[model samples]
Target: MKYAWAAPGAKVVCVVPLGASHDFGIAIDTVMTIAEVDTSPLVKCSVILRFQERPSDCWYAAEAFRPIISQDDDVAMFKAIADRGLAQNGIHVPSSSPEHA
Candidate 1:
């Protein structure tokens, strides 16, 4: 999601990753996921980062989309993703996944 906002009174802030479709594989994200510290709520029971395409504003909060993926460590999760992106281009990304993706 390119942008995110709470439900006005919700304490749980979500990490929304804004993305868009590209010529590659299927979806090519132009920018990385954005997590606002001041407005974003702490990691909680229900939190999901959805890919909100451009010109679209439809979004919602989710507890769990499916029976897969545990977002216990969001930083690690996204860091791995970034690492893969960097490795694909022979770039070094600091963190867990230092080697190739």
Candidate 2:
């Protein structure tokens, strides 16, 4: 998947660098940032990611990860209804809270 499509809080799975053992499977993590790096002739951009159970950050090539698409129809329908209601009521709210800033 393209690195530009990745967003913070999006779920992704590592597919590259299978490591020493091939028996193990892919690792999943949440995207933190598409980290900026010096341009090079031989290397691609890297992405910063964090596992929910891990405290440290990890970096991997953008090509090494794939975005996870949600398959929950109920959640999608609920979000659509909520959005429609807000729009019909002329309500507006910030996407993020001030505490996050």
Candidate 3:
């Protein structure tokens, strides 16, 4: 499959059984804001819960709670944390087969 595009973009689509739906589509919009983050100890990335369209729907889940991400499935020790949360909230992540070529 080939896609013709003009700019770089990233998105994650979640298919849940039943729950409130939200998206950050405006992330690709026209906005040039800058800031600095203190990555002194280490840069552990995490997905933040935020409502980009509504200023009232924004806040940190915790002062320090980072999820571990990995390319290998065996390295997914922390993946179940989010998976359980989703499952309990009536969300289902479709099972995927290992890709081999």
* Local distance difference test, each candidate: 0.38, 0.53, 0.34
Model 1 per-residue lDDT tens digits across residues 3-58: 23322222332334323344221122233221222224664534433333322233
TM-score of each: 0.24, 0.37, 0.23
lDDT-better candidate, 2 vs 3: 2
Model 1, C-alpha of 87: deviation from truth (Å): 0.2
**Which segments of model 3 are wrong by more than 4 Å?**
1-74, 99-101
Q: Taking the tens digit of each residue's C-alpha lDDT, what string does model 2 give over 7-82? A: 5555666666534354333354533333332234454454444444333343345566776666795578787898
Best by TM-score: 2
Residue 85 lDDT, candidate 3, scale 0-100: 89
**Model 3 / residue 32 / CA error / Å:** 46
Worst 10 residues of 3 by lDDT: 1-10
How much is the lDDT of residue 27 in candidate 1?
28
- The per-prediction CA RMSD against the true structure, in angstroms, equals 14.9, 9.7, 16.1
Distance (Å) between predicted and true CA of 44, model 2? 4.6
Q: Which residue pairs in candidate 2 have backbone atoms (N, alpha carbon, C) closer than 3 angstroms, thus clashing?
A: none
